[model samples]
Target: MRTVIRRTAVAVTAASLALLVTACGSDKPDAKKEAPAGDKGAQSSAPAAKALSTAELEKLLVEQADVPDYTVKADAKAKPVAAAGSAKADKAACQPFADAIGGTIATPAGQAVRMAVLTPKDSGKKQSPEEKALAGLNALKSPATRVLLGSYEGDGASEALNTVKNSGAECMSGFTVTQDGETTKITAATPMTLAAGEEATSWSFTMDMGGGDEAKFNLGLMRQGNTLASFYTFSLGGSVEELPIKVIDAQEKKLA
Candidate 1:
């Protein structure tokens, strides 16, 4: 009877160990199954907020002292208009082109658009060599450097950038901008290299000045949070290299 009782106790101990081992083995598969669910949860997490107010955008503009010899001021009465013959002529094709050049983006309803313009200090006064070169290249709308700052709410900045990236090729082809009774034909907008910003897109386009001579212009679009900045620089003959990069860095630092 004593031997039988001891054998029964040993058998019970063996059974308990086997059950523990089976449970441990089962837990490994359960953990492996739960890991992917945890990963999926992490993958579906919401993105960070990237909205900027108008005042914040206004503060992000490059200061006059930062870009010495340049006049940086807010355009109180500036209203962005589409390039002539755009929406009126081909609404579908022209819309994207208009947004790209005008720095216009699709924003949530009730959001206002803010803008500022930058140019050389003596843009309205005497014509400096640099000013003359820029004017000859059609880089200045009013004898200024013509950097535009636009701030949008919601996903407007991303939308504007997508328009350029997705439909730029189709919209830019045969695009024309008519100003002051003169029409300049843009043959192509080729992508250029960018050196700064969180995300940036640049292009060098050939403009038919309606003469035998053609002018080249550089357009840069940079996104910092919800703000989009545009830089336009062209020279009669000299290269306007790295100017956009400087402006982008300055603006990005301020935004940061």
Candidate 2:
């Protein structure tokens, strides 16, 4: 079971790298740019493309052929819940961490969101209950290596980027996750290197489940055009390393 978690975590981390790389390619409009008053009418006459709907955004996600040696499966669809009551920490200050699971700024409204999980072709047999539970926590677990991809379309990519960059400092302090009435405390969160995306951020954190059990988390975020993608990977009873640079390179080429 421990082995399964590690493998799944590593796989997801790679996928997360891909998502981040995808976001890096497109340039963000300058936040400070303001059109001349005289040109406002002309600009209004010709508008940007209508943002893709959630369904269209999902269709644009990287496919199996985009990532070698991995089988990409779409995650089961579910309703979006309000980003509240997902977690609680010993310190009230850490409550924000619960929002981590609530979907990123990239998440679009309505039911058009799409997500996929990537597992290595050689992942072997079925996963045990322990593995399922951990994976269920964030749906990033599998017997084989796994990576999760979630995409949403909206004209808010630039807005999302600003939100993440601004809120990251506060959220990094760490907190606890509460689900199914059970609590797991995350004691630390360290920022990871993220040089690929137009706007990207990564973090590694330690989750303490009491009784000597612990898990590590690696999370990455990226934004491109009107889309935003988020990646999450977890290791149970093990350490998680930084995502590889090649994963991003390969994914960026596919997006190109």
Instruction: List per-prediction Cα lDDT, in the order shown.
Output: 0.45, 0.43
**TM per model?**
0.57, 0.57
Candidate 2 local accuracy as lDDT? 0.43
Stretches > 4 Å off in candidate 2? 1-49, 76-97, 104-107, 110-155, 171-173, 244-256
- Model 2 lDDT, residue 146, Cα: 28
Per-residue alpha-carbon lDDT of model 1 for 1-256, expressed as tens digits?
Answer: 1121111111122222122211111111001111222111111123535565655555656776555323344444554333322322133554554445533445522222222123323334456777555543332331123455566555566566656655566655656644334444666666666643446666666666545656565666666655666665544333333334545566667756
The true-versus-predicted C-alpha distance at residue 19 of model 1, in Å, is: 90
For candidate 2, the clash count comes to: 4
